[model samples]
Target: MTVENTAEATEVGETTEVTDTTEVPAPVEDAQIERALEAILMVADEPMSVVTLATAVGAPVKRVRAALAAIVADFDGEGGGVRRGFELREVGGGWRIYVREEFDHVVADYVLQQNPTKLSQAALETLAVIAYKQPISRGAIASIRAVNVDSVVRTLLGRGLITELFTDSETGAINYGTTDLLLSQLGINSIDELPKISPLLADGADGFEGDVR
Candidate 1:
């Protein structure tokens, strides 16, 4: 009887242990979610919506949204891994990852730290014309400047300051325009923010007259 009672007690203890193990699993941690989110962001070329990312990761939208918020907060926190190193920004109505403004100098230094190449005065003048009259053709650019600008335009294209926006439908002439990177470098929000040229020219008439060829 003593041995039978001991066996029954052991069985009861085993049943209790099994019952405890059958309970629901723990919730996913924020750190785990952040790692997954970073992977998705790194692979995406454009800003990814929360719903889209949730579908890709097989996680619920609510959870993904919470995770994104937490990740942003984590990056924004003092002495955070991303603080002053990188930035998370929302552009074109979506989120994107980019290096912070403060670190741009460092990155530029590392990538393009070579001796600075100076643009000739003629090249500067050509660039100014193209930037002011974008969607303009090379012929138009040359016409306005009354000089050949093929080399200048090519240099701008090589520097990534300008890009071919489109070709004229009828003539197939390439139309050139300034890039977003150019705007960023110029510290202007848009081309419209460029200094008004007519007034500037008017203001500098005496100087222009002094240097007229």
Candidate 2:
């Protein structure tokens, strides 16, 4: 006689795993997000997207967008606050900090009257990027440098090292190039006279023809 298998029959040593996969959102603080955004924007060279800011600060996009709005309002002197010289502005499909229109001359004067001291290491690095990649936008230079190059670029321009080559009609961004003054100082006739990049570093690339001992 064989035992009949029924619906209640269970196999020995068989087990079932029931997992709770419900995703719980992390805690969000609007004020904290605003502060984080401020810090990031301070160093950012280009306008930042809400999604990008959200990912950087590990917050929701909705919260980041709201935080950006609040920042704009705060800088605009809304809710009985003092107006700021710099404002958070939306442009070129992203958000960035910009000086108020009325404060433009003040910033310009400050940049022009800066002491003629030696270029800072930051300026040197930014200049190198511009040299290697001529006709590059300020945003691109900043992207390569991984920091805001606004002040440095202005300094370079003031020092006659770099000049605005052209403006993008679509984005309105000014692309920069090393000027004749830069070439004169470097003793190079043309930008192509700059040394090839692969020769400078040591034993990094197999294709590099440098004599690396």
Candidate 3:
């Protein structure tokens, strides 16, 4: 009786093992992987690395990289369809979708027609400060404006109105300056064309406050 009971217990264990194996998830299919990659790449604001993309899609890095290459080729008409207006490109050490160079003017015109670019009152004030005191740091701009300018700086950078000219060697702070786009918008030839701030100030202060220099 003891030997018969032991054999029955062993048989039960083997059955349980087979049931567990059947519960395991199957490997992701190539078509499903490509779809997942497309969904992610569509909404991503910046270039995504293969490792990052893999983690998001729960796929292997090698497979994610392969899918990205395939997607890029598909956008380029490698699959025999007409080429898309945008293309997936690897830039700045990662991959992102960008408008094709030939369609830049069309996209620009569409964007302009969709909505006229307008600056807020705060943005106008911050722009004025940068115009007069160019090559200035964000901290200095904040000090002059008495408010944080992080988002404002990003907005200006996005609008192509300001740029990071260089980093300060001593403080490691980025110095910003108005871009040529701003100059053109302002109908000025150079930064020198900006009007003197002292006369515009209600207090007529000739010098900047603090060590913001």
Candidate 4:
């Protein structure tokens, strides 16, 4: 009977140990949460919703919101710190990090200093196609170039040289076109002023015979 009592006590102690281990969770650190938010916001192209950020960091929405407020305060020099050149802003029902409006020209000048030359070869070719046959689809440009133009198109769009004019009704393909920025760069008032393609492509390959205009 003493042996039986000892065995039961041991079992109860083991169960208690297991219960103690299972009841505790690893502590969530504030610095860890802040770092996670920084990493995610750095690469996010669009504004992130609080719920999305909470889901990403495995924290509750309220906690994530509080963290965001804390981060903004930290960046804004509210706690007797240096004011950051960038700021966290809430727009379109979401949150994103943006350069402060006062520093717009500073950033733009730095970017221009980094690349002060003409457009890249791929960008030039893509711009040429858009300048001539614009309101054209990516697939059409790819067919003409005999290579994929997705990245090139994106570059042109980013540079403000091209824009999405419209989407096809049946195929739903986005049609791209040259922007006024391109016209200004080309020193032409309108796309109609572009040089004739046939003369320029007299010695070109098989797929280069069409008039882009």
Candidate 5:
């Protein structure tokens, strides 16, 4: 009787195991992931990688990739929706939102006309850094100046003084260079015509703490 009862208990334990529920994290909905991605990209100054997005939204990389595709398509109006004035673009193995090229003229005209005031002191300094270091990234400019250059960079770009040359595939940094408008305004034929900095500084390296050029 004891052996029979033990066997019966073992069978009941197996049955209970089958009925028990083990909780696992539910899969994050794709729509939720898409919204999260958009929210992050909206204010991002730099393009974000898929791994970064996944970590941010607590979703798998695969889901983030799928959501990115949806966002790209939606912005392009591939799903029969109205095309957005801006678009999600992938550059340097990451993604960011950019103003659509088709409407560049309109934005440029508004920016140029709405603010005809001279460049601020901050803008001038930032511009000087870019002038000396052509194809420099915003972070590098900020690091050298020891201040934020987001608005200043925007102003330079809006004024057509600087332009994006290329993005670093490894670091995902966008390098900027002088534009023709800037050269024209400066009465120079090329970037090489810009004057030297050592003569202007107190000590070629004093004020900047080092040779910026």
Candidate 6:
């Protein structure tokens, strides 16, 4: 009975003893961060900002920025070895992800799939007239072309080579103009870079009129 009493007392003391165990969260992996960044880039229509990406990944802005930089650098490097891919860039006061120039064809092929033929001479001429005389109406393009350009304009719009800029003040007819993509395709920074026609025409040669004829 004395031994039992002593054991009971020891058991009571042990039951009163408290032990603390705390669990620490697992650390986030860099590979996980990189994957999250890539997923954001893939789905984003435009470039994603560092702040937005950080919020998405539940990470700090500095960390996200560092991650983006590393990812971009890696993609750009030969080690990445991905064809036709690039990184984020700042434009219009925001970041956007874009592919490298070389990959445009491949990307277009995958997404668009349909082969829309290049602009026809009539479409190009009509486009040129509108571009040089923007805020001009469809009537003006028709007059310059001496032919109906409704179909041509529609084709250009469908191809994303041109867009409606505004409506004519007098007639309320839609005014058309070239898009930045068109300018890029033409390899010119701006419309003003277009070749001067007076010199080209004055050299005993008719302008695009010759091309048309």
Clash count of each predicted structure: 0, 0, 0, 0, 0, 3
- Which runs in model 4 stand beyond 4 Å of their true positions? 1-28, 120-213
Predicted candidate 1 versus true structure: per-residue lDDT over 168-189, tens digit per residue = 6566466888876678878999
- Cα error, candidate 1, residue 108 (Å): 11
Q: What would the TM-scores of all predictions be?
A: 0.42, 0.49, 0.55, 0.50, 0.69, 0.42
Which numbered prediction scores highest in TM-score against the true structure? 5
Tens-digit lDDT string for candidate 4 (115-198): 567788978887777777777988988988888888888666556677667656566576888876667768999888987776
Point out the higher-scoring one by lDDT: 3 or 5: 5
Best by lDDT: 5
Error of 6 at 134 (Å): 1.5
Better of 2 and 5 by TM-score: 5
- Candidate 6, 16-69: lDDT as tens digits: 434445564443466699777887777664345677777777788888778877
- List model 3 lDDT by residue over 1-213, tens digit each: 121212223564563222212243454566789878888888775567788888777789999988988888889998677899999987545677777878755654564455466988888888877877787988999998899988888677657677667656566576888877677778999888776666665567634653222
**Model 3 RMSD to the real structure?**
8.4
Segments of candidate 5 deviating more than 4 angstroms: 1-29, 146-151, 158-160, 184-199, 202-213
User: Native-vs-model 1 lDDT?
Assistant: 0.67
Q: lDDT for each of the candidates?
A: 0.67, 0.76, 0.73, 0.73, 0.82, 0.65
- Which pairs of residues clash in candidate 5, taking residues 3 or more apart in a chain or in different chains? none
- Candidate 5 deviation (Cα RMSD): 8.0
